[model samples]
Target: MTTLPSSTRRKLGLVIDLDTCVGCHACVVSCKGWNTENYGAPLSDQDPYGAEPSGTFLNRVHSYEVQPDDGTAQLVHFPKSCLHCDNAPCVTVCPTGASYKRQEDGIVLVNEDTCIGCGLCAWACPYGAREMDAAAKVMKKCTLCVDRIYNENLPEVDRVPACVRTCPSNARHFGDLADPDSDVSQLVAARGGMDLMPEQGTAPVNKYLPPRLKDRLDRTEEIDVLAPFLAPVTDQPKGFLGWLDKALDKI
Candidate 1:
């Protein structure tokens, strides 16, 4: 079985803002497109246009209606992918050492060449991040777009993960978690970013910012702050509108 490194040089991961994710799936589409073209074996699909279509995807968005004690029911869009955990069970459970964690950047990856299409990694992963590519017959998961991140040919701005780049709402972030001064780390500190299932003890690198509750609209006792703006300028037509109204009335 494989073993994890004692420590990694950097904890590179994502910081997802639950408040801003719009559930548009742009990240999912971009991930599929980029990985298929540049990364390892193509992500396969069976009957893509048919009724029962299924395919391998590294990123996915799941929406759920949640009700908080202090707020009304709200729809939350959650994007899930490989967390690249510090204590990655998938890496340690791999019999052939096909799955391993990088000591350089702390990215968990599967060695497809040495991978015997074994589903051990999938079983060991608590997040259900791994998916089987039907055509390639190999287990696949998110690689944090490792190829794009370190490429010198690409512009510095485009070095982030495809999900972070394509997020229309600017909900996704990528940076070194090991650096206390990184923007991602600062955002996490400001927003109180939390881990996914801390009870699992996987120590996932990715963090999620909790959605801030919307202002209550149903309460009648409290004064509405936008009352002035909500009030009309005048019930009767006035200014340019008054002139237009008089002309229309004459007609």
Candidate 2:
């Protein structure tokens, strides 16, 4: 069986803002495209155009209609992925030592070459993050886009996970969570981020910011279509033209 590192030097993970995610599946599509083209073996599809279509995917968003005690029912988009836990059950459960956690960044990964497709790691994972690839016949999980993140050839802006870069609503953020000053850490602190399932004692590195209650989400009143644009742009004249108008009046 595999074993986890005592500790990682860096806790590089994601900070997902639940309130901002729009559930458009942009991240999901980008992850599929990027990982298939740039990373490991292609995510296989079974009868994609047939009766039942099933495929492997690293990141997925599940929408739930959650009714808060104080607030009305609202649809929450919960994105799930590998948490790279300090006590990863999947790593320890791998009989062939194919599953391992990185000591440098705490990113849990499966060695596909050594993997026997036993599905033990997938069963061990609590978040349901691992998937069985039909074509590769191995367990596939989020690698944090390791190939793209550290590639020197790619532009700096494209260094993050494809899910983070392609999130249209900017719901996903990737950075070193171990760094107290990192943007992801600060965002978590400010937003009161929480782990996926703290009771499981996995010590998941990735965090999720809770959705803030908004009065607008539940209000049944009809919105005035022109209410916002009705407001005046400025009491004073607009920029350059305004200055010219004033100068001409003075003349």
**Candidate with the greatest lDDT versus the true structure:** 1
Question: Model 1: what TM-score?
Answer: 0.88
Off by over 4 Å in 2: 216-251
Query: Relative to the unseen true structure, what is the C-alpha lDDT of residue 245 in candidate 1, on a scale of 0 to 100?
Result: 96
lDDT of each: 0.92, 0.90
TM-score of 2: 0.85
**lDDT, candidate 1, residue 209?**
96
Q: Model 1 over residues 1-251: C-alpha lDDT tens digits?
A: 37999999999999999999999999999999999888788998899999999999999999999987875889999999999999998899888888889999999988888888879889988999999888888889999999999988999999989999999999999999989999999999999999998998899999999998577778743667787778887788889999999999999
Listed in order, each prediction's TM-score against the native is 0.88, 0.85
What candidate 1 gets wrong by more than 4 Å, as runs, is 220-223, 226-251
lDDT of 1: 0.92
Of candidate 1, the 10-residue stretch with the lowest lDDT total is: 220-229
